[model samples]
Target: MPIPDEAAASAAHSVRHLFSRRSLHVPGTRLGAIALPAPIGRRHHWHYWWQAHFLDCLLDEHLRDPAGNALSEARKLARGIWLRNGGRWLNSYYDDMAWLALTLQRLDAMEGRRRPRRRVRVLGDALRSAHTDELGGGIFWNTTRDYKNTATTAPAALFFARAGDFGRAQELLDWLRTRVHDPATGLYLDGVKADGSAGGVVDRRVYTYNQGTVLGALVAVGGRENLEHAADLVDAVSRSTADDDGALPLGSSGDGGLFAGILGRYLALAVSTPGIGARAAATGRSLLATTAERLWTGRMQAGPGVFLFPPRQEGPVSLSSQLQAWTMLEAEQACR
Candidate 1:
């Protein structure tokens, strides 16, 4: 079934009411709160990466309907993030910075301005700096740099590709291909430890978001080999990660909640990007449409005019989980 734009917009509005809040209580603070519900204590937490995804979703809403106020909301959230991060954008996690940089890049692109270029450059440079010879040449996960992982490197590659640094992007993707790709499952592994405790040991854990970001990076840095790999990865995800009903695995609350939606986001990208193969495109579209339909059908009313999605239908509603559902709906809408 086709997912309508209204459904996606409703998902966006629901999330905004339930989770989005001003970064601070002070006057003129742009909306930027990502918190739990009242039942869950409504505590405000600072998750740099989650805020990045929230901003991206706002942009998605704006793009879906240009006449709406979502752009204004996105601008506020951007400012809120900047102010909340102590008037800076750099963070300890390379992956977090990369995600924010990507959304900022999109904002810049949509507005036809380079206003966020400086921040994007700062993030791109930080990602570049994180790439070292350690652990077979990939970006480190955090500032401590004890491990190199796809969580950081894949998105970093995507950020670089979007920033017109194809060379660096290709370098990062090559590192993943050599060090992190698991031939057995046709999916990428998590990361390899570079610390003394587990030096050079591969994590071997396959995550939905990692596959999504890698698919995005592959499509962004398009070539015969990369496109072929992208097609194979899509098929692998459809075969391995999805249930018979086409619903991808819903991760736990907190950061894990965004996993399936992240995969959905890039799967939508694969569906739209040219030369990803017709089979892969169909696979991506079917997965997104089916999963989004399921989520929409299963949504529960939290209160009057407040609808939220549980983590997996039985789990508690968190900012990440609700955002994940919204993201999947948006993905399906975009593909449609």
Candidate 2:
């Protein structure tokens, strides 16, 4: 576990090159976004929205129509996923609804095809449902208030922001602010004990995604502490998860989609606020380019970097990663 200089340097160069130019030239589409993944990509979670958000930013600000031919596929995949879901949760669903809803919202802003109305409503309801029977303190993981995890809250906030339900989103945000905090390290507690605050905590390890979730959520809700805390946490996660290039390391899953999506969301938030460094925008670009290169070069576009267990069972990456990759690119454009 030394470190990979080539990967780090290459990624760092991506940041410097983009920042120097100051804009992306990505393709602009009607909302379909980009091309479909080959090898029967799983609709497991998140269509292209996660990645599409990044691409939209790129097109709106940086690249030159990088997603022209892919919009049709993007739309098809997006529509197909909703068509079958009946515009609602399909069990085992965790934090994906917000991801999808945000995608729809971004696509709506991009405006073009005018997808199914119920599809939008369904995502709307799914996001609102995140507040179902709030435990007098905050939202539950699912229909049951059995356990509360750290990761879901940020997506919850993003979903609400996109839905125009800022009030409810703010409440949940407030609850999360108090509940998941760790007095020991000022880090989030990760998981809750159902009736208590310390039990069944599977992943207490603070990862970039975990903290990114916070930054993304807080930024969406407009909280000062959340923003500062997110920035601080990001620095911590970055120092640990990121390699020399400022790109995240493979131990944190990779330097591609995970890096792009998580950091891209934070970057977008940072760009909106004043005083962020030029490196922030550049790093955002570098990550997206790296992410795109990953998708473009990996497996047959199907089983590329897709993995189920991750590090444990390499290969066969997930659709979420691709979606995350797409989003970072979109965010990169926005950074400019």
Candidate 3:
């Protein structure tokens, strides 16, 4: 079923309003950059990863309304990310660096400017360095190399795809399918820990973002099989992750808070893919539409545009959740 244009427009409007209301100015950043608050208690420090997502949101807004100040806002956030990270885009976590690199690439394309080549090279090197033969293959979650999880690998795959390095992206995806994919579920597991051995301990937990990132990777790679697999994952997640009331489950605070929205981004991609079957496209659309509807009805803050996830103990209203909500809305618009 087609999403009513009114629903899409309302969500977009709320996103703009939420952004204007909740986005906060971080001290010492460039003129236009702002940070959204994390959960209530730890809202003190900005979640660095969320800032990367923020840039993506700004880009989406800019594309939707080019005359708006979205471009300037994105540039400010990019500068703020640099300044806040001690004048470096590279971070301790390879996955984090991968996300920043991908976002910067998008910013560069939109602005007709290039990010420093050295920064891209260093970031790519760090991500590639983290790949090991552990658990039969996949990138480690961080410098510790203690585990290989989808949280890290999926985004790394996306970064590789965006860089026009489909060889590496496919390699990562193939390894993930072999090592951690749950065939029965048509969903990828979290990851496994390995010490240069076969079959390390596996997390086996399902996360919306992991499926989402792979969907995004498929979008970039654009093979028939990849699109088919992406559609399968979309259907699987729709059936498994959602509750009886039609709302997708919120992962948790911190990283989890950002999960559904991440999935929403790829779900949108899947629906928009050329040659997508009507059934698959409808599955993706229904999932996003219901999730957004439930979220808006159940979680909207007393303030006009703000939204708060339940089980408030998670922290002050999280910037991560805010971004997640906005991403879902942006995605809904994309699907239409």
Q: What are the Cα lDDT values of the candidates?
A: 0.85, 0.47, 0.73
Q: What is the lDDT of candidate 2?
A: 0.47
lDDT of 2 by residue, 155-200 (tens): 6776676566778777766666676765455555565545453433
Model 3 spans with C-alpha error above 4 angstroms: 1-45, 113-117, 299-315
For residues 1-336, what per-residue lDDT tens digits would candidate 3 score against the true structure?
444444433444444454432233565343211223313432355556777887787787777778877788677777777776777777777778777777777887787765446666677888899988767778988887889888788888888887888999998988888877899989999889765557788888888788888888877787888888887887888778877866677644577777888888888887898966788899888888888775555554636654453325333455566667667777877777
Model 2 segments more than 4 A misplaced: 1-70, 84-94, 112-116, 132-136, 183-189, 195-203, 223-226, 251-260, 275-336
Which predicted model would earn the best lDDT? 1
Which pairs clash in the backbone of model 1?
Answer: none
- Model 1, runs deviating above 4 Å: 38-44, 114-116, 195-199, 312-316
Comparing 2 and 3 on TM-score, the stronger one: 3
